[model samples]
Target: MTPEQILPSPQRRQTYWHTALALAVLAAVVWLARRHWPMVETGAVRLAVADQGWLLVAGVATVATWPCSAFAQQGAVPDRLPPGRLVAAQFAASAANHVLPAGLGAGVVTLRFLMRCGIPFAGAATAIAVKGTAGGIVRGALIAMLVAVCPGVLLVPSLDARYLVAVCVAAVGALALLAGPLSDRCRRALTALRAYLGAVHARPVRAAALWGGSLAFVALHCVALVAVTRAVDLPLPPARVALLHLAASTVAALLPTPGGLGSLDVALALALTAAGAPAVAAASAVLGYRLLTVWLPLIPGLVVLGVLVRRGSL
Candidate 1:
């Protein structure tokens, strides 16, 4: 009945809510991941792992993505961040990315890290935008280069022209609708993004790091896929397999699914199939790729996330 005991403190209530939300999200991601697990044929996974050497190479490639991501993130901002903590933050962000759609979780984690490093909110947002844009450009460029180098390696299914036209029209309409109602905050964000780009261009080292790291990040991912394909004994040439991965992953990025789960699996399998891989081998390769990229590291990544959170790094 004491006055001090009449109500819970705001901080305590906020902590309780945050913990509840985290548990709920964790449960949901676990359920979804479990449901999707069956898509990776267990037999194929077993066979793929039998080639321990290739599997090890694939794992190394997968682990390299963290430092590449850290480099790209650092390049996006002029402010210096502690290299060790920066890499740890990227590792943690990967785990967080699995729990939210459209990369929101990773963005939240990175934004917090940037703010903690003394970047203002707008600058942090702009840096993320720049990094993402650089990544997309590099991916597209790689796909184009690969397609040119190995013409006919990728066999994109023909789509009806009318369907494409309809998509274009819909996109235009959506943009028109949004243009008329552009919020002040969005306008400011756009301005900030432009300024950041100018600054990035002015700094050659930063620009090189941003572009180089983005390119390396994507190339490493494709190499990892090639490693998996090799482990699975897929007959496709490594170059072709890498190209297929780049194309499929680029398409899969549109899905906005957490870590591109179902969408990426289907897209990659179909791409491999189109490139003349045996159906079974294709499935096996995809399974192996995801095993190395997602399932295997998930636990450790989550552990890193928890450690960073406890240490107030994220």
Candidate 2:
């Protein structure tokens, strides 16, 4: 049969676009990795795991992030998911997040999973939105608490007010342009989101799970960072280290890079240095942190992703 007959037009177009986007994102990741390979290599070689026990704890914390994420995700929705499958989907989502920028990969996977569980599209989107909003609030609260506890620990240089103003103006302009076209859909989505949020808040159990899971997720990540610092014998206080990580990650999340690969490594290393860690120690900690959180689980995560996709579970 002819090519047009073999595959329908819209589906074919979507497939091509997806393939192109994937290739572009992959290329960007590879380029960034290659550019930053020296630091990672040096850090890996220089790392001295002082205590195997601490390293094990770090690994456990890293593994724990998946369940934390799944719990938060389930808490966003009213329906209960099959526990094992929910965790597995989250594991797979982590791998996917490495391939796409700005957590889009994870969002897509979670959206699919929610749909498979019988949620309508609007409801599923609302759940994801609620989870993300709760996470942001928790992260901000943690940062604020840490900063208050350790005043002047995070000394990020001030940016020009004009630059900030310009960025804000541009963003507002873009949003204004899009608003006219998307107002109807935006209103519908917002209404649905408000309703879903109200429902979640009405249920104390789900509300607690949502906030608790969000806090746990960020805490575990900090704990993993602490473990890496100890693994390398970096002389930074645990609280300070956690604060620095939170600040750096919050900044890096704006970059839209896959898993915050290149941007996060540099930002985190710099943040550590600013927070009083020596250059070598900071680099080592960053490298070790990424190794445990991203590189190590990557292969197995992808394997799980493949299994899920093959079974039509993702």
Candidate 3:
């Protein structure tokens, strides 16, 4: 048989390997969870999520974060994708992220959505990177501030050390952001981001409103987390909890795992324990929080994505 007749195409090979890797990783996580399931406190998990107020707050935060994040992502694409279309694309991508293993399936789906909306591949790629990376920068700054304001937070052991690392990283990262060519690179990566902000720059009143709205959106999620921790009555102090959140989220963002699922859980558990909370309680709270914050929005996002697609808005 000729080579062409005997061999699979390169695209098929790529797809096969990617699927295999994803399956392997999923199987490993399942096995690990099953093996260690006994260590988790099922009862605690149940109790933590029962607080209606906290759950409501978490939902609000998750939704609010989307728009602020979308704003951050705005200018990254060229005019190929309109703002409304990009929003639909983001929602669709987020929906895919929850169902797809390894977390990148959603990103790929989103990239395709952008392309469909007329964004160049290069611009889409850069925008995704910036949109994701900017959150880390914000978290790192928050952690550094915490370290200075509440040095006692360092006593949390696992978290304190991470806070220190974030402080250093933030300093270096900020310097890089400010560096001339690097700043320009980031600007190019977020073309829409620049356009949106610049268009409003002259109107200080409007600019202030945008900044305030964005800040409120980001803060709501953090507040929700804090509220959940309190609702569960976890032993950790509020300051320490905030620090842990900053560190865990930053680390999770860097993690290769989809949505930082397993990694975020482990980090939260450790941070809680280190801050002197009972292991089972911490596990339960973290699990409950993830369900509310991550899995909950996922359902609606999927539906929205479908709507967008059907309407040809995505």
Candidate 4:
């Protein structure tokens, strides 16, 4: 029998894609561990000698983020999604997020899950945008508040006239609204996102879930980072540590890094150092944060991702 006749064309194609996905996931894991082994090692050593109670708190905060994320996601969509599955999907999405730049992996996983839950492609995309918008707003607000509270923690470089370059960049970007290659698609997406945001907010309970969940998600992340700092005994106040993390993470988000991997590592370390932590201690704290939040959850999250894919839940 011919190969196509033996296995059938569609089944053969599906098998190939599945194999590719598995390999990709494995390669990503290997690359992440190998690339960041030094930091991970430093973090582990620090945690070993540091406070185990704070370490436990960090771990708990890390785990809580997934459920908060699911809550916000559910609010973004109009349908009543299964809470357990939503939370599991968020875990899988978080793992996938570190594999691709600019959050593509997480977005794809979530969009697929929404599709599985009977949302059309456009609606799913819009829901994602609304959720993203809510998260962004919460982060921005927190950043503003932190800046007010912690005046010199974030070193603001002196105002230089060269800063006008930013103005020029903004002007050029504004022009992208009218004539850039993706201008039309960008406009349409914005319009749809606005409409979706309004629709989601129309229901008071949904609005609460959306904003409250987003706030919880960000706060949990800050708490995790702060707890890690405490675990590693970084000489910084908890509120200050939280502020540094918020600012550094916001900056790192602009770099298109996968889950802000290298960018976040650098940013967090620098932020900690700027806030009076010794270099070695700051590095240890940043590594500890990554170890708890990213690397540890990764394998189990990937397992869940595979199960979801196999069951057509994503």
Which one wins by TM-score: 1 or 4? 4
| Clash count list over all predictions | 0, 0, 3, 0
Could you tell me which residue pairs clash in candidate 1? Answer: none
Tens digits of per-residue lDDT, candidate 3, 1-314, equal 76557657995676567566655555766786787687565735556456677667766766666665455555333243465766666666767776664557667766767666666776567556644555555666677887787676655436677889999999998897688767777777467666644654556544444444445545666676776776676776667787777777666554455666676777777777877887777777787678766787777888888887787664
> Which numbered prediction scores highest in TM-score against the true structure?
2
Local accuracy of candidate 1 as per-residue lDDT tens digits, 6-111 = 6468855754565465555456556755765664456365564558899789989999999999999988998678999999999888888876655778899999
TM-score of candidate 2 relative to the true fold = 0.82
Put down candidate 2 lDDT per residue, 147-225, tens digits, no spaces: 9888889776999999999999999999999999999999987787778888887888888889999999999999999
Worst 10 residues of 1 by lDDT: 39-48
Each model's lDDT? 0.82, 0.86, 0.66, 0.85
Residue 313 C-alpha lDDT in model 3: 60
As a whole number from 0 to 100, the lDDT of residue 300 in candidate 2 is: 94
lDDT for residue 245 in candidate 4, whole number 0-100: 92
**C-alpha TM-score for every candidate:** 0.80, 0.82, 0.67, 0.81
- Provide C-alpha RMSD values for all models, in order: 6.5, 4.3, 7.1, 6.7
Candidate 4, residues 1-314, lDDT tens digits: the string is 78888888897886666446545545665686587678657766776787889989999999999999999998898778989899999999999998876687999999999999999999998889889989999999998898888787777777767678888888998787667777788899778777877788888889989999999999999999888888877889888998999989988787656787777877887788878997667878887789899999999999999999998899
